[model samples]
Target: MSVFRYTLLASVVLPAALSTVPALAQQAPFPADAGESDGADTIIVTGRVQRLYRAEQTTVGKAAEDPMNIPQSVQVINSELFTDQGARDATDIYRNISGVSFFSYAGVTFRGFRQDQSFYDGQRGNPFIGFSVPQLFNIERVEVLKGPAGLFFGPGSPGGIINYVSKTPSDTSSLRMVATGGNYDRVGISAEATGPVDADGIITYRVGGFYEAMDPYRRNTTNKAKIADGAIAIRTNEGGKLTLQATIYDNYLRANRLRGVLVDDAGNFLTDIRWNANEPTDFLHLKSQAYQARYETSVGDRVTFDAGVRYFDAREAQKYHEPRGLDPANPDLVRREFRDQIRPVHGLSFMTNATARVDLLGMEHKFQAGADWYDEKNVLDSRILRTGVTSLSLSNPVYGGAAEGDAARAALLPFTTTDTRTKRQGVYLQDQISLTRSLLLVGGVRYDHFEDKVTTSTGGAVSNRSSYRDGDVTLRTGLIFKPLPDISTYVSWSQSFEPQAAASQDANAGGPFAPVTGNQVEGGVKTQLFEGRLQANLAAYRIVRRNILQVDPSLPPVNGVDQLAPIGEVTSKGFEVDLAADITPDWVLLVNYGYNDTRITGTVAGQAITNAVGDRFANAPRHKVGFWTRYQFPVLDAAFAFGGEHVSSRISLSGQSVQPYTIFDASITKGLGFAELLLRVDNIFDKVYAASGFSAQSGHFPGEPRTFLAELRVRF
Candidate 1:
């Protein structure tokens, strides 16, 4: 069988083994008699945990107990919610969280943080994006922690951090399978299972995998993907455990698009788009593999040690087509281009967490402490292409590519292509100190050091360019106060720093510049309501980034001479709100909103003058909003939901601006014995706007329009 078919068949068969667990696994137990708020009531997760109606004892035990104790603004997106929404990609799942937004660019932003600092499962995933690769199917939950995690993880932003929780061993045993298809002829299938392997019930394991593919919701675009993932865990009565997890994913996309520039009647920069939907075509291909092995053991009643090693490799290649005009007369022309990028990232992290209930001189307190280490390597090979010969320039607007495609496409010299490599490593530690029953203090710190190397290739020969080295210390501190059993409020301050790669843009560095450094300071409050059935959190932060990276306009393009690098600084500030609740049994609500005010705060010499449509960072918007909810039908045994995302207009990396647009989406599901069925709709309005462009204006690829998908999921 073809890989796609084989994937679907595996998904279908896995669930057959789990159905024996009984009908209870087929339908969630919380929907029945959900209204008795005070009776064996369900707790509301407030975007913190999966929107499940489970008590503290039912959820991950150690996890559920600390939400009210931490001072930082954090959130947990549960696994059940993943099933409830049938989320297909990381963007589909995380874009709904507050303080986070996936803008018009293919870039992601959290609060005011740039795309430079993203990680997966607390380990580095996409070194290029601010967030790591999308969470996979076996994810148990998603954790979003705000403020500098410098103390426990590495040098992370005070804005927040994201960790994809993998599904591990569980006492509950069951099997699951899923099949789906939708607009763009999109198709996906997958399955999973958990149970004891021995009659003694001393050992258990969970395993699953998935396959998916889809076409562009747009008329001339197509998006297809294939995925396979699984996990196995062995458990014993001593609380000792060892597990293995793996995934293989491949994605392909093609588009006949607009190149990266847009001009008005007089040919002045108006937007970041190149308005040519009909062209020679552009495409991107990506292949990724991630595997991890984890081991956990209990040392005593108060101490537990967890250690894991994860390895991930991703290779991506692209041919970007740039179409630079909007006047029907002058056809779009291809411009700036990127060739190859490969990231081989791996990390070995060992954490010793000791939690103990201690009588400290007459007062009872809970104590937790740990240490961490991380290493990352990044490699990028990029090329810039610009035709030496000028097109009609609209002087004679009535010229076609047929008239120009020959000479214009011919004069297009590969100009300059450069290869870059980055290496970073760090170590950290954290501690939670209790002062009183109602007042507890939290603090942690981390130190990091990084090394970067830049190499350029011309005619196939590689040459060394320059290198960079830098280090910094990050910190986090907070306070929590619980005046009542059902309520807890806290305030926190956090910080994070990016490498100095952009620093090369400093006037002192001359031509090629170094990486920039970014940092943030934030304070926020979190509260739980109605005995923790409902939750809400709000935070405000200021981010001061130095030597903001931007192309050096002064550095003219030369075949083997110089490269453009970030040459300025910009400071940004923002506020965020996150909420989740179970207003009543059978009804669940989730929402996240972010507001940002980012602008060029400082500029180097000649920067302000030459940059007419330049300087403002791309992929960032001033406002973002999203909401989703599911309401169950006790009698019909089903539920339906609708949710969508809205983003304000954004600026081009080159400083041009794109108009603002909003998208709406929704879905529905049904329950059956040992199975559940679902139907999902995306972009119901079929808006023909840009959902994502290439790094703030390379091409105008239409966002997916209205589409539909149906899924059959079974539980054993």
Candidate 2:
């Protein structure tokens, strides 16, 4: 079953766990329990969506029909939810996932982790969020495998990894279209079709594309993207099959980089903003193109192989005055940052899996051995625009797009800039040996070698340069026990490693790469209640990393936030729990919590190098929670959705108590013949607060007020 339908099954598991959803729904919109649909037990519950039916899953690798079960905390965003939710981009797909929030400051957030460190399919899809290009649209479903995934992914984040699955062609010939319009003048249209290439059924093809546009509250109101993707598969009579898929994406953006707000003499934060209240030519612009190619094949009955390659290119430029209060070094517009970048990535990931039955031991074994390689080349040219000192306020939210009449033009500086390119190579072997009818064992080890090199933006300069040894090995072990047909529990542990780029000063001093980092994790998972319809994965994990790297700004002259700080040592640890239930056939519920004990375990600055008595991590809140639910109106054959999301209160500017906040949302959708209609209202009642952790110049601003969207889809 697709991951989505599996999540549908997750919705069914709830009835046996909580029978009090109706009362909760009637009260607060963001009720701790989440939604109001806790009544119905007729939904036929099955396996969770481990495999989502969409364009991308086919890109990860070929899965064996009866392959050994992988022990990991995996979640899927299925297509059924896709059409129902009208998800325009990768960010929207996780609307109901708890503790997972999208931070425009960087990228998508999981628990307290950012998307920059995650993976795409099983490749090196991770990139710095602000500049990372997006490749989504005709996606199949998104797969999230939690825990230290160094073996599965390359390096960077030790928090976990996320993969986006693309769509693939099938033997069925059919076409589907989806179109929608909503608040913020948002509109989107997408079409897809699958058909057989030959009457003999040897070849098949699937093609899909989409166009979308919207106006947000950010500086640049116009946001749009266009995508085209297709896949082809060939089946042979000898029990072998091959599938290949290709995709291209285009994006257009014009938005003021909403920096932080400015605090006044009285401590009041300002909102009205502009490129430069003193300059009229400031502008923001960026456009990109991305392409992906994948291939997969299955041999005989005991072995399978999958591989893929991807490339991306973008021409991006942005001109924005550094915000006043936000930049501690200089509040005034001493200089501005103008940037241009063209980034392309080339990488390949493939694996082979085989099963063997041992007669002497009377046991069956599934052995999976695979190799992986990745490389990324980043080209950047940034120009600093200087214009002495400009006018007031970068924090004030400027709504009218005002004009500053007699302002001077910013003078351009001819300084060339550049960055170091990164590359990684890895290989692994895993074995799952089934010992008894009720027990199974899994174990594996992996090794990776990574290299980074720096260069000048203009090719006029070169250096044998700074480098570091980024090679390490890790192992994974797990045990599964199924005493009952409906009850299964497993305990698993995995190890991962990462080596960060050198510090700026070190680089300037001809410094070399830093020490390689390592993280070890262990946790137990449980899939319980009601014939496997309900699943609650409770995991207690401690991520230990050595040679921890952190930027510090505590050096005498610098007591505030610094863009240029020294790299120090640190260790972050946390715990996570997620529960999904079908509750009843007519009602569904989802709830999750994350407790991250993130601290500057070690820093050279002694007592207050990083965490002060009141200082919190940049964007992480110790406590994170989210809940969502949908209940079907049996009489109308439609579902009504409602839920609330929240983050506990925390400090923003080293001081100030910006209270904790929560927002509620609701919607309903009905399936009618070949067409389905959906209606949703977000931020119901318009509770205002920063959805992003960033607060107002004062303390906090209201989140997106009441907003709604209506959509429809058709298939033949």
TM-score of each: 0.77, 0.79
Off by over 4 Å in 1: 1-65, 104-106, 125-135, 156-158, 218-221, 254-283, 319-377, 381-421, 502-521, 547-570, 604-617, 692-701
Instruction: Using lDDT, give the best candidate's number.
Output: 1
lDDT of candidate 2 over 230-287, digit per residue (tens): 7788885465566666666555554443444333333233443212222224344444
lDDT of 1 by residue, 1-716 (tens): 24533443332233333323233322343443332122222222222223342323211212224666766666777666676677765677755677676543333566655443545545555422211346457667777676555555555444556666667766767776788775557777777778878876567777777777765533234565666666667774488888777777666656522233344322233332223332234456667777877677775665666666677677665554444434345344323322222333333333333455566666655554444444444445444344442332322222234433432453343434454555556655555666776777777666676666665665457654666666777776778777875566777666666565533433344533333445556666666686555777787777766654545566665654344455566667888887778655556677888888766676655555122234455656788888776655545555656677877766544554545668766665666544566766666666655543333334433455556667887655
Distance from true location, Cα of 17 in model 1, Å = 39
lDDT of 2: 0.54
Backbone clashes, each candidate = 28, 43
Shift in Å, residue 657, candidate 1: 3.4
